[model samples]
Target chain A: METILAQLLNGLDKGGAYALIALGLTLVFGTLGVVNFAHGALFMLGAFCAVAFRQFITYETVTLDPTKLSPWGAPLEIKTPMAQIWFGDFGAVLINWSVPISILLAIPVMLVIGIAMERGLIKHFYKRAHMDQILVTFGLAIVLQEVVKAIFGANPISQPMPVELRGSADIGAMLGLTPGMVTYPIWRLIYFLFSASIIGAVFAFLRLTTFGMVVRAGMADRETVGILGINIDRRFTIMFGLAAVVAGLAGVMYTPLVPPNYHLGMDFLVLSFVVVVVGGMGSLPGAVAAGFLLGILQSFASMTEIKAIIPGIDQIIIYLVAVVILLVRPRGLLGRRGVMET
Target chain B: MNIFYLPRRDAITLAVFALVVLTMPIWLVPFGAAYPGLMQKFAIFAIFAVGYNVLFGLTGYLSFGHAAFLGVGSYTAVWTFKLMTMNVIPAMIFAVIVSGLFALAIGFVSLRRSGIYFSILTLAFAQMCYNLAYSVLTPITNGETALQLTINDPRVLDLMFSERGAGLPSPSLLGQGMSGIEAFYVVAVVLLIAFYIAQKIFVSPFGMMLRAIKSNQTRMHYTGFNTRPYALTAFVISGMYAGLAGSLLAATDPLAGAERMQWTASGEVVLMTILGGVGTLIGPVIGAWLIKYFENIFSGFNDAMLHHTFSWLPQGAQDVVVAITSKFVGEGWQLSLGLIFVLVVVFLPGGVMEGIRRFSSIFRNRREPGPTGALKTSPAE
Candidate 1:
């Protein structure tokens, strides 16, 4: 029971990430009707945004201190972060909370990026074949990754979590069970809640608002929505920006768990594409459900006892599920008929 | 117009192409890439790209997992070397058959879906193969360090030929050791044969069916023609081509690494095909050669080399040029490749072949008297 609970927690935490990335992917696919292979690059760019913010806020000034001489008899240089000099204790606190603070930086940055990407390159490919879209976007993805690599180098850069949430929380004890039985990371719990809220916010935006209704209508039938005299293209472009922001936020929050690297986008891109496929293309709710399902399935597959029977199943569980889901339900779990059927 | 008949113009082009390929070691020296190993890779990857074009160019099925077949071929060839003689022939044959079977299984399942779904399925299957090769099937794959020749392996035919205590023998054709230039020639000959087969397929009725499938699958289906078998056959044949390339890689290098099965490698073939011009016989080969050249020669350029090349310029100008051009070469080759890919896809949908045709047609038009004469010399011709 303890093991199951722990795995479930792990699965949910992972599922939150998968769900967030897949949601953005599905949104772009649903609205633009172009398979954005660069979606993962956006996620990666978000993580880098966090890293950049942290670096920017913590910019240091070096001064020579005569009292602290080095072994070579030269004056030792004392470096003080510029934020600390400017804001004192608040600077330290801000640095500690940089991951959360990065959301502000990421939103505008990602929106501009998403809009530029849509208007500049993907706009031309709207009438082209899906293969062409995929290839061009893939090229764009490679360029984005390489640009990141050029700036930050190829190594994974770790982003620190807030000091208060450094350790695991005893969920089992809180729930009146054994104290250490279901201890989970506080940050992970926070991430899950955050993802849930984002998902909810997106849903509410689409369901309740008139703008979102029109967007939804556009997703169903672009020509019909256009016939209704709605500038669905502009709305769709904004939705693309929204999708980028979502992916960016997911990446910003995820940096504390997995270190940001140049290749992180490509890695997640493949899995997220699988998630989108398993959930059915252009199906938002299906993407979220499939993400969690695959995450949990992958978590379960990774258990030692299970892996003992089916060696390497953990590595391939997501892809295996995708294959199975695709074979069994070609339209996916909640996919509407005729969506990407041709 | 006969399918089997070689048109006089095409025959001349083929002869010229063959001559260029055969004399690559000599001609490529001026480009600072005369090394036999590099020349062999050019031929090998050209075969791989040509094979990929059969499915992607003809049928418009963007398979993102073809590298799995390549890996299968390489592993099979290596295993053949381990168990049997160090003869390239039997190893190549075994590699093709094994990879062909693997392709058949993967293609059968993946072909059930079309468009993005088909691509995702193929990608998933390839990733599964990669994970299996990397971890679960490490015993077969020899994991991480790459599968290479072992000293204690059972070489039944090898034992029959040479004495028991000789060092690991190089892959040979009959009795002649295929090393250095000989290996390049061997690969070049096989490449020519592969190109010949691809050309035949391109002109064949089967190729037309594939093109039809690409243009409109629904129309073909409604007309009583089964498209599934045609797609599967194309997939298998291409898989065999990839397999042959893989075996040739092993035959030249005598090692098989799991990295060969990576999706990025599969993507590389796709890039090669698209960069050259899809659905055109010569485009893929040109793209393959260009890519391989960029990877090998262009990537070797560094700041020092750049500075040396541009020494006549002022120091400030040299520095500026070096700084700018440096990003497109060396470790930054992929960035340049990405930019080129985007630019090509955006501007020239038909690839470099289209660019050449357009350029030549512009000259042809200028040479002609008026609009009527220009019209007489159609662009297609």
Candidate 2:
């Protein structure tokens, strides 16, 4: 029973990440009909943003002291608040808190990147066939991955969690169950809450706002939306940026969990795509449900008992789920008619 | 003689082309660097590309999962080798039949959708296959490590034991797999001829119907022609060709891995089809050669090689030049490929074949007087 609960939590966290990325992809695809293959790259860029911000906050210039015994010592230093809290033991207060500071820094940077990508590359591809658009975006994704690799090098960067959220919380103890085996990471819980809030906010914005209505209208019928005296193109472009922001923010929060790498995008891209497909293509709610569902399935598939029967079932669970879902419902779980039909 | 009147010109060009291909390995014998193994790789990929062209180029159906068929073919051939005698012919035949069956099942469902959805469905299926082969079907696929014969395993047809040794001898016709430049040359020549025959099929009446279906399926449906069978036939035929290529791959390498069915591998064939010029006979072959060239030769370059070659230049100049050129080769080859895709889609939609045709047309136009006079004074006329 405890094992099952633990697996369920794991599933939720994994599903949260999947939903975030798939939500972003579906948003762009839904609003613009442009299959943004670079959506994964955008998420990758967000994690890189965190890495860059972390580097900046902790940056120190060393000067060679020829006149003194100590060589390669920094003459002056500045420290961040969290840095002091975390690295007070080493007497390096300022830069020690880089990870927490990176969150604030990731948002604006990711937003700007989202806007730039939408305006610069994706804008040109909106009018082409979905395949052509997919090709271009896929190309853009390769370019982005290569560029990131060139800048960061082909290595996974380690990120220490915030000092406050460093340890595991004994949920089993709280429940008065066994003393161990059900400890959950505080950071993971925080990540799930953060994702849920973002998802809720996005849904609210789309449901209650006028801009959301216009975007929904655009998604329904671009020709009719245009005929109604609205520049649906500009709106769609903004939606693309909005989608990128969601994916980027997901990456930012996710960095602490997985520690981002250049090729990480490709690793998640396939699974996220399956999530999108299984969720009923353009349906936002469906994407979330599918993400969590597949995540749980994946968790269950990784059980020792399951592995004994069928090795590598965990790796193939989501794909098999996607194939089954697609065969049964060609339009997907919540997919409307005429979406993927011939 | 007028160019339009010279249908025989194509035949002559084909014969010359066949001669040149057949003679290439012999010519390369003096160089010794261009081995038969490399030539065989080129032929195998070319065959795969040609099969891809059947569904994509002729029928306007861009399948993003053709590599799955290739994988199926390879696995089937390897299993056949394990079960039956090490006859290359039978393996190739089994590959085709098995791959055809697989395609029939996949195509029946996937073909329900068209355009981007169709591409995605195929891609999704391929990814599923890749994942399954890597994990769930590890007993059959042999997992990340390729399947190989064990000493205890029975050879069903041969009634002989593979000598209990550290490593088993390669399964091939007579004894060992094809060796030296001569074997590769033979394979390449055979494939080239087969490609030519396939090309003839592309221009045949049946090929024309496939083209018609591509242009307007609904019209054909209304006209009482069962378009489904035609499409299915094309899919099966292409799958068979892919299987043949896969069997050849197994024949040469003697192992099948899940990586062969990757989405990127499927995408590579699509890139080849588009790059070479879709619907044209020679395009896929040319595209295959170009991509394989990039994959092998271009990616082989490293920073050390670059530094050594440009040592005489000033450090900054060398760095700048190397940085720019490296995208075309080395680790950044995919970037170059992506750029090529963008440029091709945006500008030369007809691909490399179209460019070659245009270049040839200019020369032909210069030599001929005018269309009216040229036709009136045709050699036949």
Candidate 3:
């Protein structure tokens, strides 16, 4: 029972990430009608935003300490982070909480990037073949990743979580299991909650707001919406920005879990794409459902008992699921009829 | 002539192409790219790209898993070398057959969907193959270290010929060692044959059917013609082409790595096809050569080489030039490649062929008297 619960928790944690990334992907696909291969780069860029923010806050101020003298130097130098020097305790708190603080920084940054990407490159590819869109966006992805690699070098940079959130939580005792049986990381749980809240917020915004209704209507039929004298293009562009923000925020929050790296975007991109396909193209709820389903399936596959039966099945379960889904149900789980069919 | 036959001009063009390929070693020397190994790779990858074009360029199905076939070919060739003989012929044949089978299986499943879904399915299958090769199939693939010839392998043909000696024997044809410049010729010949087959298919009814499928599959379906077989055949043919290329890669270098089957490798061929001009006979070959040249030659350019190349400049100017150019070479080759991909896709959708045509037309217009009149009158005429 404890193992099942542990696996469920693990699965949900991973599913949160998948859902976040796929949600963004489906949003862009639904709104723009162009498959953005560079969406992963946006996620990577978001993680870097957090990294940059952390670096900015930790910039040091060097000063000479006359009272202390070095053995071979005139005087000892004291180095303090500019944040601490400028704001004292609050600055220390800020530095410790850079991950959450990065959410603020990533929103505006990712929005601009998303809008600029749409306006500059993807705009022209809207009318082109799917192959052209894929090629161009893939090219853009390579450029973004290479530029990131150039700046950060080709190494994973670990981001420190806050001191309060560093340890694992004992859920076993609370759940009436053995005391030490179900300890899960506190941050992962927090990430799950954060992602759920974000997903909920997005859904609520879409459900309750007039702007979202218009956007939803536009997604269903752009021509009809446009014929009704609505500037759906601008809303769609904003929708693109919102998707970027979601992906960016996901990336920002994810840094503490998996160290940020130049290739993180690409790694996540493929999996998220799989998720989107399995969920059914252009179906937002489908993306979320498939994300969780695949995530749980993956977690279950990783169990030792499962591995013993089908060796290396864990590594390929998602792809196998994708193939099976594609074969059995061509339109995907929640896909509309004839979405990409000829 | 029949509608499916090559035009007279196309026949001459093929001959010229054959001549250029045959004499590549001699002509490439002036450009410092005459090394036999690189030249061999040029031919092998050109075959791969041309085969890839048969599906992607002729038909608009953008397969993202062709590298899986290539990997299959390499593995088969290496195994043939290990178990049977160091003969290139058997290895090539085995590789092609094995890859063709694998392609048939993968294509049968993936061809069920069209467009992005098809791409995803292919990618899924390739990634599955790659993942399996990396983990469970490691015993067959030799895991991450790459599969290479070992001393204890049973070489039936080698033992029959009494050719056992110190170190591993090189793959040979008719008792002649197929390495160095000899291997280049072998690859070049095979490339010509591959190109010939591709040309024949391009001008054949099957090729027209593929083009028709690319333009509108629904119409083809409604016309009472089953489109699945045509697509499946193209997929298998292209897969065999990739397999042949992979076999040649092993036949030349004699090692096979799982990385060869990676999606990035698949993406490289796609880039080559598009960059050179998709659907054109010579475009993919040019794209392959251009990419291979950049990968091998441009990446070899270092700070020292840059400094030496710009030695005629003043000291400060030389440093500045080297600093700027160094980033786009060596470790930065991928960046430049990305930029080129973007620029090409954006401006020259027809790729290098389109650029060449536009350039030639500009020169033709300039050379003729009354250029505007000539341009207007020529189209009407």
Instruction: State candidate 1's DockQ.
Output: 0.53
TM-scores vs. true structure, each candidate = 0.95, 0.86, 0.93
Tens digit of per-residue lDDT, candidate 3, span A147-253? 88877878998899999999999989888899999999999999999988989988987889999999999999999999999999999999999999999999999
Better by TM-score, candidate 3 or 1:
1
- Of the candidates numbered 1 and 2, which has the greater DockQ value? 1
lDDT of 1 by residue, A39-156 (tens): 9999999999999999998899999998889889999988888778899999899998999999999999999999999989899988777777898999999999999987888999
Each model's lDDT comes to 0.89, 0.77, 0.89
**Residue pairs in candidate 3 whose N, alpha carbon or C atoms collide under 3 angstroms:** none
Per-residue lDDT for A210-275 in model 2, tens only? 999999888888899999899988888788788887888888888889989998887788789889
TM-score of candidate 2 chain B vs. the reference: 0.87
Docking class of 3: acceptable
Order of quality (TM-score): 1, 3, 2
Between prediction 1 and prediction 2, the one with superior TM-score is: 1
Task: Tell me, by DockQ, which candidate is best.
Answer: 1
Among the numbered candidates, top TM-score falls to 1
Q: Taking the candidates one at a time, how many backbone clashes does each contain? A: 0, 6, 0
List the DockQ of the predictions in order. Answer: 0.53, 0.31, 0.46
lDDT of 1: 0.89
Model 3 segments beyond 4 Å from truth? Answer: A60-79, B1-7, B304-325, B366-381
CAPRI classification of candidate 1? medium
